[model samples]
Target: MTRRLMLSYVALALLVLLGLEIPLGYLYARGEESRFAQSIERDASMLAEIAEESIEKGNLTALPELAREYAEDNPGARVVIVDRTGRLLTDSAGTIPTGSTLAGEPDIAAALRNRTTVATSTGTNSADVLAATMPGSSGTTIRGALRVTYPMTTVTDRENRIWAVLALAGACIVTAVALVAFALARWITRPLRTLERATAQLAAGRLDNPPDADSGPPELRRLAAAFTHTATRLQHLLQAQHGFASEASHQLKTPLTSLRLRLENFEPYLDPRAHPSLEETIGEVERLSRMVHGLLALARLENTATTPGPVDADAVLVERATMWEPLAAEQHVTIAITGPAAGRVRAIPGALEQIIDNLLANALRVSPPGTTITLARAPGAGLHVIDQGPGMPEADRERAFDRFWRASDSHHDGTGLGLPIVRHLVHASGGQITLHAAPGGGLDAHVQLRPAGRERRFQTIAVTHAAAGHRR
Candidate 1:
């Protein structure tokens, strides 16, 4: 992330530099060329005026010497004199032929037409040259023309120097920007990395090494402090849960042992008439044992160390449906299952199965005879358990997951821990369950499971059972 941020910052900076430099360089070059042209024009006009006065006075003897002296004083200028008929009369550099015609030259032709002309050209030395021309006149009659050529080397040199300075300044600015970007990126990302590592350790059940609250930026520091507080609260809650499970198990053990011993001793002397009551008592003891086991399981699940694994929700539902079929049939309840062919969820297999079993048992007990109880998978990765029993009101639904919460005047003999156990197991698996009214007047229990990668197989099974003959 830091690398990405730095790259983005640099890219933006380069774009800004490009936007500023291109137009500025073009304007600078143009202004330099304009100033060079203007200087050449002004010098050419002054030389033309001096020559016209000298010629008018019939000072032909002084003309060549005056031209030579002017050329010597201004080393950067090329001065030439041309007659009315286009002959080159005087040349500053003697290399040119003495009588070369200047008729075809662009600036000279313009001057002969009585128009001052300025033009630019390139020389053999690869330097820019600005040339200007004006006709020599006395009282508006043209005699000859004076032409001056100035090399633009000095202006070119100044531009190069300016460009070099700009390049150095740009380099320094870019370096400073990069350093600031790096420091800011580190300031932002260092705390986030530390928080991420601390979160991983906490999830692994290492409560001893909570993150330091002093680390990171202001927002991250506040988050770290909040996380520390949450961890402390979680530790206390887990300790209390463990203590409750241990006490509850101890409280249940004595009665379970006495009941088991009585059953064993009474079986040899029992008649067929007394067998039903003994069996009923034994069933209640087994149910008690299951509830105690569920409590312990729930306590273990609450610890952060437990991570749920992938399981087939459809398979779990099918298995529980098969196990409870006989009981549902005896109670005169119709059990039907319907859904997609497969669905998978992440959860503890045993705990999930137990939750399904408990919901099935409770539904069968409360449902009227010949009523249809449906167990269907929801549209996504979830289960829906619907029963034709007296539905819970809104208030009851709110408190339904509390331990030992049973509806008023409920006929079924239940420890009232079924819904709470289901809630705990679902929450541990990172899922949720909701209770509502079923269509056609009954209770609906919705259990949503976390979606997993692989598909699961699902097949609906239906069973018809009578209520009077139902056995635990």
Candidate 2:
């Protein structure tokens, strides 16, 4: 951003310099050439007047002397005088014969007709020359043509110098603009960079380095102050939530457990017909207890923030399957491990084990005796807990992640938070979880986790340790 801003400033400066300096330099050059042409024209006209008397009387003796004196006064100038009959009378450089025919030259040709002319042409001594030709006339009768030629370098050198100076000045201004623009860009973006870091930290559930409200522009300052307030309020709310979860963990579960135990204790003393009602009441109490615990667990999970790191998905799958094997055997159900290995997957510390445990437990609950519960590693960084039980409808699968949403045909005592908690953990690990029909007609809990390619600074042993609600 800083670089882009600086370049923008420099580009704008260059545009302004080109717009101003180009025309200024061009006009100065044109004005210099105009002034140069006027000086030559004035010199030629004055010489024409000087030569008028000598040429009119046809006295050539003093004309050569006059031309030589004029040439000596102005360096790199050639003077040529042509008579009325198109013959050179005298040459200032003495190179051409005095009677040489010099009438064909454009400036001389125009001047012979009593018209004055000034233009640039090729020179014997240089590549370019500016010549001014005027008729040496007496009483409107043309006597001779007087032409004065100066090297074009006389005017071009000044034009070149002016352009060079303008270019240097423009370059200096552009350089200065770039430096100032760089400084200004940095100054403006420094506060934005601070805000960016603060926003990222806030999104990750902590704001370690809060932005300074008074350090930047007024608009940014106000935004910083608002962000700080929002972060403070969020921290306070999370703290209150954590406190509530901790308190409710003990308060809510104790009464529910006591109620279930008290109701069960009355089973021996109650009438036979009352036993059914008592059982149902106890079951409701147990379900309520599970619901309270599930909600508290969710609250606690949401209160803490964690970054996902590499975990050996295959190892966790095998370990979980082994752990749940005894429960499956007790129900005469077979637990089968299949499929290829799911390599290192991204998961929060100890989250993979909890996810696998929850999915397998749910699978085993619906699975019938003599049926196989398959624990498989799907393609890529994925896992599947396939069971031989009745699969849910497509609509129910979509709402399965909602808290306390139970399937209509669910028969077992469940709090209906198993799928929700599983989804929460999966999503926190940057993964997706879905329920599909198994091959033989059961629910296949398909979980797709991100692949952890590089090593990170985390305790990889956490993946093998116990997970939340692992024992329960």
Model 1 agreement with the true structure over 1-472: per-residue lDDT tens digits: 7888777777777778767776677688788878878877888888888877776776756666767877788787778877766677777766567679997888787787778988878865778877789988766687778888878787788788777776777777777878888888777777676667777876766666666667557887888788888978876887887888878887887888787788868977999899889988887787777767666655666553567787777887788888888898898987788876446677765767877776777778767878877776556554676776666666777777877666664555576677787777777777777766666665566666666665453211211221221121
What's the CA error at residue 126 for candidate 2, in Å? Answer: 10
Model 1 alpha-carbon miss at residue 50, Å: 7.0
Global CA lDDT computed for model 2: 0.79
Return the TM-score for candidate 2, rounded to 2 decimals. Answer: 0.81
Each model's lDDT: 0.72, 0.79
Residue range 238-295, candidate 2, lDDT tens digits: 8888788778876989888888889989989999999999989988998888888888
Task: Give me the displacement of residue 383 in model 2, in angstroms.
Answer: 4.1
Prediction RMSDs, each to the true structure: 8.4, 5.3
Superposed model 2: Cα runs more than 4 Å off? 1-8, 51-54, 57-80, 88-102, 120-129, 149-154, 329-340, 367-394, 408-412, 431-448, 454-472
